[model samples]
Target chain A: MIQKILNEFSVNFHFYMKLLAEHIGIIAVSISIAVVVGLWIGILISKKPKLANYIISVVNIVYTIPSIALLGFLISLTGIGNTTAIIALTIYGLLPIVRSTYVGITTIDPSIIEASQAMGSKELQILYKIKLPLAFPVIFSSIRNMVIMTVALAGIASFVGAGGLGVAIYRGITTNNEMLILVGSIIIALLALVLDGILGIFEKLVLSHKLKKIGYKRFTAVIVAVIVGLTTILVTQKSSKDTIEIASKPTSESYILAEIAGELIMNETDLDVNITHGIGGGTANIHPAIEKGEFDIYPEYTGTSWQIVLKKDENYTNDKFETLNKAYEESYGLTWRGLLGFNNTYSLGIRKELADQYNIETFSDLAQFANQFTFGAEYDFFEREDGYKALMDAYKLNFKKVRDMDNGLKYQALFDGKLDVMTVFTTDGQLSDSRIKILRDDKEFYPKYIAGFVIRKDIIKKYPELEEVFKKLENSISEMDMAEMNYRVEIGKESPRDVAISFLKDKGLWRDKDE
Target chain B: MNKIIEYDSITKSYNGKVILEDFSLDIMEGDFLCIVGTSGSGKTTLMKMINGLIVPEKGNIFIGGRNIKDENLISLRRKIGYAIQGNSLFPHMTVFENISYVPKLEGKKEEELSEIVNETMKLVGLPDDIKEKYPSQLSGGQQQRVGIARAYANNPKILLMDEPFGAVDSITRFHLQEDLRSIHEKTKCTIIFITHDIYEAFKMGIHILVMNNGKIEQYGRKEEVFKYPKTDFVKNLIAMAKLS
Candidate 1:
């Protein structure tokens, strides 16, 4: 089972590593931030009895909130994916750090404090030179505990589409792939254990000034530097490709570019567009990448470009596409090419047989049967401005139940007939392949998402021909073509680039002679 | 010599019980005043008030003519060296370090402190070989000597000792009392000594205040307090010393 899991991870090593980096990064950042903040707060509170009591009570209360629920609550505000997870884990790791700091600082001998005071040391000087040094052992150990909790909670965060070993583990569990599950579990456990051991040595160093005499600290530093250097070299060496990297979220347009547009751009333009997939909270993960010139191009939706990207919320009809295009052009220092052939709205998806049998052709018709169906959805779909919850409230549909499923599993569950219905991305290629029929929102419950490749504002100035490349892709791949392309890559187990190339050739956008 | 300390109408209580009421005293600059009181008679509490370690409920303690308050506490405490039984010589610090602690606090450099520590330890008859040893490894008598060494390190104007010889053997206690007399002659530090043993008090104390309950039953020169025995409390205390 372990071998099989290892093999599975080895096969999708890129996906797992990216996920590991993000989850572990958030946890690392959060814990460090928490330690610095918590230690100071703990020390401050130790000095002030009344303030300490109230801060401790607040931390205790926050700690009592379940990790998963807190992540969900955070996701409601920050949207789905790793950023939300980082936020939740940061908050959860505070209590141990705060409490330990408080206990440690307060427990120092009163005589020591008196002696310091008698020596003409001010409160601040005594705290740093004496109190903190005395409290170092306790504080660092609490941070060790926080690190462990951080790794564990970082895994939980991955359930909200926050990539980490958690995503791999959850994916393996849902698919009943024991090998994948073990791969994620073992790696995560190993990471935590190794980090814990490192912190153990750190705690010893802090407590025992004698360790400085032994040269053990210098030895540890050398070992850490070597390990980090070797890991970075190993990861970079493994991803050998004639690669053109494009950073993107795994949304509808993202899949289209990865499964369709990437190959087209590469084929006609003589570039190898390596689609480095990521999860998105709209332009948060992509726009900055474009501005920093980290990515060459990505398929960003028009509605997001309008409301989420351009920072405008004025309501308009489908004709607002021109307004969005003009706004992107005027404000964002980027070109907005014309749309992809379809409108990817928030589709109410159900099992095809159920939809056909019940004659539920539209969201209004489906509302009458809502009490009998449980809807599964991504965390953001329940909270986004144009999310399913807002749509549900607008249409007054009282569903029997609502379940939040991770992005990777929501569609799989729907296909398995485990979920009665789901709020799905309109451009998601899964809707076509899984044979799940989507109920039309006859009341126009969501805005139109016209897919287009968004590049850095300066890319146009760098390469004027990029505009021609986007125009060639405009209205070329329809909804059905995008779905077939996703099936070929995701389900057929073909490389996403291969799938994209084959589709482009079949569409005659690129000929065999072009390569 | 001027008076180094004065306790005026100093009253004390613990948990609604009066332990010391209207207690008063004056210690001339170099006087070694031993306050002899039985256990629970508020001798320790009175000594603590004199050092500003404890505050009196209804009266003031003037140390170098300044009332014990936040404004004068640090300087007042630095000038008064205090030691309790078990020697409370910081367990983690070596004897040398313990002796040099107060001098260092008074901003004395290492050269000056080292000289003072060695001289103080020698004056108390602590051997040079045990200078680096911690208090825990030392004998009961040695610990008490180190305690005295530390008290005199800073050249304080006054020293308060609470039952300093109580923890040592009788022979050691007698020798320590004699050492205290010679050390006091050399340093001229005003010592307010608290002891339950009336005989030791009479021998060590030039002036004795025989205390019972919360008030002084007799106060006069050591010979006079012992000879007069005015109140029944003082007489009983005198009788108890003879029986012990």
Candidate 2:
């Protein structure tokens, strides 16, 4: 297992380095801003103690908010990407810094203050010359905590389509690839520990009497260097404007489709392509991001675009593709292209043994034995308009128990026999397991989720050749092809880009000869 | 000797209770005056008024023949050295930095500040090598000397000490007292020392002011006050000193 992980690390070394740099950039910028703002507020409250409790209470309340929920809330206002991630991380980084500074300043020996005052030291002089130096050890420890916490929390940045090691972890979980998850987690922990050790050395240098003067100069130099490095990273990132940004939902299939689209665009067009994998809420986040031009294209499902994005009340089938495309182009300036020749629609899945024992091959057949078996699905399945409730009402089926499990854990639940039946997408990589039987939607109760690319109108206008590249992908991938590709990445531990390129090459869609 | 500090009819109260009522006193130039009092007798408060650290509701304090209300308080404090109990030395600063703090605030040049620190340290019987050490690295007696050096560094004309040696052992206290006496003789600065120990007052003071309940029980030369006690409080304090 260790050797496999080491191999994975070596294979994806450049990918990890890029994400690591982005992670450092996010932490550097956010922590620098937090320190300045937190110190100012801390000093302000220390001077006016009447305001201390109220300000600290406000910071404490913000700190109590779960980071993921905070990131989700920030997405509406800031849009998605590093801006939203930085803002959320900065808010999380504030409480410790503010509280520590306030406590450190206020708790200094009163006699020391009195002595300075009596020696003709002015208020500002005493604060700078005496109080801050005395309070530094306390404040530095909290900053150390903030830095370590920020390093770990930065993993969540990938959720909102921001770049970080979290992309690896999120992808790992979505694909049920344990190696990627373990590697991402271990790297994040190591990053935190390394930063903490560095800070410990810095603290010692700054606090030691003989080394104080030189240590301060070195500390300032380190801070300046970090700021410069982060600025360069941010500037260089923004300089690449002739680039296409493709996004994917947190699923192996979405990643594969995005990689395919990215490979095609890069090969055929005179433009660079950046793909952000495993966006947190799928279409819910990616739709707004595309409209804001933060992302240029993403793989979205027809039923999801119609119901979730367009807020249509009815189930969308193959016949409504034109209306869905028209609504997207007219209202959101987004156009759907490249029907990937698959219906990854919702289906009931059961263990093959259970299916045979019950003689159930369709929704209607399962309805008879529903009361005897436990049903499980991802959390959103119960909440979506065309989800669990609609399906149950359509078939008049009521199970003995229903479990709301994570999308990643549902397959394991079914395999363990803890779940007798569960919701599954037709092209889900886990569905390729022979032990699980995909039940027929004989009643056609679920909406048709034909997979395709949704691109911004402006991107299509800029790179007209992209439309031709996407057209070749139209009706090209069969359901088996997509499931097989997903299985390769999810179970076979193949890179999505490699899987995507191979799939496109096999179909003669890859323009490697022209490139 | 000229009167360097005079308080006229000072009235001060806290929480509707009078701490000092109609307090009046004169501190002469170059006098090593010790004020011996029990707690709440307002000895520290009275001494603080000279440097404008305390304000009396119904009194005028004249320092160096000028009404302190007319003087900038920072400038006034710069002219009057003040030290308190427990020798509140700033723990983060080196001994040299602590000693030269006031002079630095006065905008002395780096060389001048160092010279002043060296001179003050020598005056306080501190060795030259301890200058770079922080307060936390020093012994209790050493910290107290640094505090005294800091108070005297700028060479103020008046020094107010409120039990500056209160936290040190008796041996250290005796040595500190003798050193302070010599420092006073060398500088000839007016020093107002407050102490709960009457013997400390008798041994070190040129003049003694016995205070009880914020009123002056007796005020005169130490020998005169000891020989001719006019109040019961004065007699009791003198008797305590004799017993000790």
Best by TM-score: 2
Candidate 2 lands at a TM-score of 0.92
The alpha-carbon deviation from the true structure for residue B10 of candidate 2, after best TM-score superposition, in angstroms, is 2.8
**Tens-place lDDT digits, model 2, residues A200-282:** 98788777864576656776898789788885886588568888888999988898999999998887778898888999988
Docking class of 1: incorrect
Residue A459 lDDT in candidate 2: 86
Would you estimate the TM-scores of all the predictions? 0.66, 0.92
C-alpha RMSD over true interface residues, model 2? 1.0
The C-alpha stretches of model 2 lying farther than 4 A from their native spots are A213-215, A348-423, A433-442, A513-515
lDDT of 2 at A176: 77
lDDT of 1: 0.73
lDDT (C-alpha, whole model) for all candidates: 0.73, 0.89
